[model samples]
Target: MSKAEKTKQHIIEKTATLFNTKGYISTSLSDITQATGLTKGSIYGNFENKDEVAIEVYKYNAGLLGKTLSRSFSDEYPKALDKLHAFVDFYRKNWKFVFSNGGCPIMNAATEADDSFPALKNQVKKSFELWMSKISTAILEGQKKGEIDKRVNAEQYASLFIMLIEGGILLSKTMGDQSFLNHALDKITHMIDHELNILPS
Candidate 1:
């Protein structure tokens, strides 16, 4: 890519975790400069302002997560039901990655941006919308294929799944324990098998 594009990406990558951890208000220009090894002038040269840079950083952080989940849906699992299971398995297996990266980016941003950062809040909302849509789509597809029960409410379950997963991540991060997330995922598994899955005839 162009020099400016690469530099912008470098800043985003370096400060993504910083913002996720320290938050938008708490993460100062010094933090960005320190993380990216760029002077304030260089940072401003690459972006219009801190808010602009933060918007991009949020995208970068959320994108990392979105891409991985996207793969779980597209790759390895042909059946929609299996894809849903893979979704839970991903968090179960990769909670460390999520925690180390400063917790789930969506959760991080949601808490920070809800009241103060409107721009970042909008971005977070879009991410949630897309995520909910994907999960609901998977459920609807499964019903069509006869793998999932048709009576299941795709949109409602999608909302519940996001709530449970995000809530689990939040609780886990707060408690400094992974079992909170595991408990939430366990509930999801039970819901999938008993509430959503179709029994063999």
Candidate 2:
């Protein structure tokens, strides 16, 4: 890549945690300069404004999460049901990575961007839509394979899963207890095995 492209990526990478942790409003130009070791002029040269940088930082953080979760579904999770279980288990396995990166980017952004940052809020909404679509598609695929119950509402289940997981994350993070998330995942697993899973004759 070109020098400018590399520099822009560097800024994004450097400021990702700052933006996620400090938030859009709280992360000042001075903070960006300090985090990226770039002067204000240099930062503006790369990004149109603080808002642009914030948006890009959000994308960078959220993209890393999306890519990581997508990577969880490999040959080990060939079956749709297996993929669902893997999805639930992924949070438990990767909690360290998530915590290190400043919590779930989507959830963090959603909570902060609701009314204040319209642009970032829109991105968060899109991220959630895409996430829900992925879950619903998986449910649909499982139904086609006769592994999931046809009676299950794919969209509803997808929404429910997000609600449980996000809420669990919020509670767990607030309480400094991982058991909340663990309990939520356990409930999801039970729902999948009993409510969604189709028993073989």
Off by over 4 Å in 2: 73-76
Q: What TM-score do all the candidates reach, one by one?
A: 0.97, 0.96
CA shift at 96, candidate 1, in angstroms?
0.7
User: What TM-score quantifies how close candidate 2 is to the native fold?
Assistant: 0.96
Residues 39-109 of candidate 1: C-alpha lDDT, one tens digit per residue: 99999999999999889989988998999999868858889878999999999889999999789989888
Q: Write the per-residue lDDT of candidate 2 for residues 44-131, one digit (tens) a residue.
A: 9989999999999999888888877775455567688888888998898987777767789999999998999999999999999988
Task: Report the Cα lDDT for candidate 1.
Answer: 0.91
Determine the C-alpha RMSD for candidate 2 after optimal superposition of all C-alphas. Answer: 1.5
The window of 10 residues in a row where model 2 has the poorest summed lDDT is 69-78
User: Which residues of candidate 1, in runs, are more than 4 Å off?
Assistant: none
In terms of lDDT, the best-performing candidate is: 1
